[model samples]
Target chain A: MRLAILGIGPVCALGSGIQSLRTGLQGKVRPNIEEKIIPTSHGEKMLPVYQPVAEGLDRFIPKRALRRVDPFTQIALLSTYLAIEDAGIAFNDKSRVGVVFGSGYGPTRTTFKFLDNIIDDGDIGASPTHFANSVHNAPASQVSIFLGLTGPCSTITCFEHTLSNVLVTAWDWLNQDVVDYVLVGLGDEYCDVLGFAAVGMNAGRTKDMQPMNFNACTFLPGEGHITFLIAKDKSHQEGYAKISEIRMRRDLEEVKASISNDPVIINASGNLQQGKSFLKVQQKQLKSYSNLYGGFPTSSAFDLAVGCVSMKDRKIYPVPESQKKEVKLENSIICLEFCREDEFNIYKLE
Target chain B: MSLELDLKKLIIEELKIEDVEPEDIGDEDALFGEGLGLDSLDAVELVVILKKHYKIDLEDMEKARAAFASIKALAAYIRENSEVQ
Candidate 1:
């Protein structure tokens, strides 16, 4: 809590970098949902997936340099470059900055590719490159190498709670004086295996996500990465918002009882009958960006990234299209990410 | 395809080597460090490629290095061991 967010970077289906998010909030961009063939238990299945355009990545890492790198690593690397470039800090002593990445599923595409090789060709045919990139911390390792960060580097995975843990870890590193700034981020790429599983698992699904409709699983698999460059010191000229507090609770009654008319973003994208308690926060004029990025387990990170954009741009992006409520330009925003009725995290930004 | 040309294609595809074509690589050019600039990872990938394509097992690391010196050397090694020729 109380960490200053110097810069925020987001790469999603809409596109890469913060300007893409600004255009997305302005409703000027749409993602090209790519279809791929995946063999399921029944037969071969073609499913739609949200893939990032990654247009700005070439400016940071040339395409030839990234040919050997997996897509998952490419996504994370782009996010890091965007955050650093947005922060506008020319870091001479990179050892003072650390890296921490969270993920719902680490390198699913590369891991599956490795397994595919093992299945098609014997173990002898397995490519060593795929095996090396399949690990959980590979992205973080690659980030440290590219950024030349001698500070502590690590990765964490806990499904929906991954973002909360990542932020807390960043704050802890700053508090402990282990580093001056922390490059904290979360990402999960959508592959054919996950796409097939998502279609099979959710019977009440749709092509678009309705995050406000807590009664339905109108969800689709989305892919991308989001990063925040955080520092304990706010010496920089501008910052997104200060993380005032992070509270984990089992109920929203207190939050609703103390809630104001100010805008609050509800991370309510999930299956029906579960996470319905998030509907209790309707007392506040709400905003949700799940439609722009689609639905994923670590969507809370995406929500926070949207919150940062809203904080910086002084505008609340519309969801549900009707836009019944208008949030005052300047005010504190609270982000509520609900995993269940009893398990959720509340982030206060001011 | 000829064995030498096939090995060249395999090197480019399996190693994810970009911006280089089969014709660009000389028949007797070095495959690692000074020539194509492939390192140990590429060497390991080349091993898997050889084993998968020709069923030729270069268990001896030195012999693998010798064969990997050039696409022509790799093709000759395959011809000496593999029955396709």
Candidate 2:
């Protein structure tokens, strides 16, 4: 599949867009913090969530449609616009380009609010406005509407593997000459219930978490939105990253066996089993980026953003807290696990 | 049988509290920390619930947060402030 990445935009806990992510990844900084408690019965008191600055976004998204879309969807819409602008693609281009998005906790928070209104008050009391925006496919739908695109609009809700799935699917469409371009997007947001349930669920298993399971904390309740513009035979100037090779598998052993040489594995968690397995394989040197990126399901999207930036700059950053280990940098492969059983994605960035 | 009982039932239903009936919820017990396990979001939902069911417009967030302590408290607050038609 010859899909060229024209531009990438990301809004996460760290900051807004690709530059914020790049700075975060490069500096080994941790951006997780407790925000104000939301008004919900859900357990999250001070939830760790990512919210983007509202500056410069109004120029990209329209006002009428913006009224309905939530922050996450708004971020998605903004990223799409930025990606199109970054790609130098004109909105007037009437080509049938599709938008494929991956979301881990798709519209759950919004749906939950609607559920509250329905269960608490009567159905008539439920906010028709909120109810309309609760669909899982809302981001893509809004993107389609924003661009007035009459093309294939798809949404994926497969935990963290969303980006790989969307990219591969988009790649397939491009490979088959089904579409000229695909706007691959990823978005996840924090709701009080989700954040509380996350900590509650984590506490149930790990019981004695003193250091507070930093990896899980980063993910359980953070909000992030990112988008990449992939074009066929359409390579354009200085600020672009190519989607080199995206592969997913059923288990981690396949990843271990598949990774050829010194690679950067952005393990979602600091799990010893997966960490040790990478060490045992001896395929190549492994540098961890998870500590900096945190542990969100779509966190790999952030790491992918970093990798894309690295390819453009020709540099590999060390693990955030590597402690002056004098680690050598090399052309690295990115490996990750979507879940315990599911072998995540391994991106070979050039 | 009373407005308080009715409010209690509505809270449990709204908050998705399983296994507990309206009669079981104590009037003076805490609704948030250590009592009914309701959090801030649930409190917001409760405020919306009251406004819709009882025509009580709880514009004050602080007062609503306090009312969410328990069914008894919420019922009293509702009785005092509700604009029932």
Candidate 3:
């Protein structure tokens, strides 16, 4: 199942919308890496993290409406609003538009707050709002409730597999004619626990990421939400890119053999090609924007966003100005995201 | 702070009733619908707030409807309940 990306709504360290994304990808603007202090088992530790917290949410949704909503749900709502605005469609029937959201972590801060309520005042003193927002599907529920979207909605929490699952799910839903359009979302948040863990994990301050060197875990924790409004027909708005095929393979040779020709490897192969000499020796134009958007498990959504934008702009924007490459319209971009030594997902876009 | 004022702040802060300041809520204004526009979720939060801050454990809102009628009423109810408890 394939769907055309009608609109892109991404909120990250680089900023919101495709313009900000394109600017950051072109290396025109640099996202400042801020320091966050988190209390861990070994006391508190300060670490570098990317806090792309959703801003000015009151502009889209009423402030009162967001009273019980947590930060995780707030970003999901904001990104959904952005995707809808980017599409610029006057829907005849909003109930037919389905929503699918994916996340690496769902409201860890809220969950911990609920736990605090339990600790401070015991089990009976737990807060109702905190308890309600602590679930993994709370964001998706909030989005549908606030927007009054009556269509089929779901949330997937699969860590690194979140982005691919979200896209593939939306693709299937649209192709199966279950809905006219599918609004897909992928997000991960940086809370206090994740912050100290990233610090203890030795997330280095390497300003750039070496895509080929998988051993160097120089990824700082980042938080953001990237959404796409996709449909079978893109006559409503200008499309960013069309998803042709998405495949998930658990074998190294199978994944490698699938992309034997010149493929636009979106991000690093990581553990997907263990001992695969062809992938290591192949002369491919590897591009990674990890410097712009920091590192989270589902950052590949940002990669896909960049790929779609690159295809739209007819130029691939590398992190530094030196790695600039012009992309042709006819070239098919294969975004390879690896999960484990023998597990990977491929997204082919033109 | 007066019990009325403190309850108003809790209602706004914990109940998350936005665009309205503590002083904006009148002493005689209703805490639920039409007066302050609080809903069932806000009712649940108010119950927790009472339990957490006032040490007044409410088993349910069925018996507290009159006390929650207004901020003044709620304050008087709390004072009366504090003495009894």
Each model's DockQ? 0.71, 0.05, 0.67
**lDDT tens digits, residue span A1-350, model 1:** 38888887788888888888878777778765776666677776655667777767788877777867898888899888899889887777788899999998989989998898788777877888899899889888988987778999999998878888888899999998888889998999887778777778662246566767778777667888888899885555577878878776537676775457667787766556444676656654666777778677777788887788788778777764445543445787888777665456888787
- Span of ten consecutive residues with least summed lDDT in model 3 chain B: B76-85
Best by the DockQ measure: 1
Q: Each prediction's Cα RMSD?
A: 2.4, 11.7, 3.5
**Chain B alone vs. reference chain B, TM-score for every model:** 0.92, 0.85, 0.88
Scanning candidate 1 chain B in windows of ten residues, the lowest lDDT window is B50-59
Q: Quick one: ranking by lDDT, best first?
A: 1, 3, 2
True contacts kept of 2: 0.07
Say which candidate scores most in lDDT. 1
Span of 10 residues, lowest total lDDT, candidate 1 chain A: A320-329
Candidate 2 stretches greater than 4 Å from native: A28-32, A35-54, A62-65, A203-220, A233-239, A250-253, A270-284, A291-293, A323-332, B1-82
Decoy 2 TM-score against native: 0.70
Candidate number of the best TM-score? 1
Candidate 1 backbone collisions, by pair: none
How much is B6 displaced in model 1, in angstroms?
2.5
The TM-score of candidate 2's chain A against the true chain A comes to 0.82
lDDT per residue for candidate 3 within A44-157, as digits (tens), equals 666766767466677888887788898888887888888888878655677888889998888888998899888987766788889989998888888888778888999999
Task: Flag the better candidate by TM-score, 1 or 2.
Answer: 1
Better of 1 and 3 by DockQ: 1
lDDT of 2 by residue, B1-85 (tens): 7877777777766555766788777888887878867666566566667768887777787887777777667777877886672
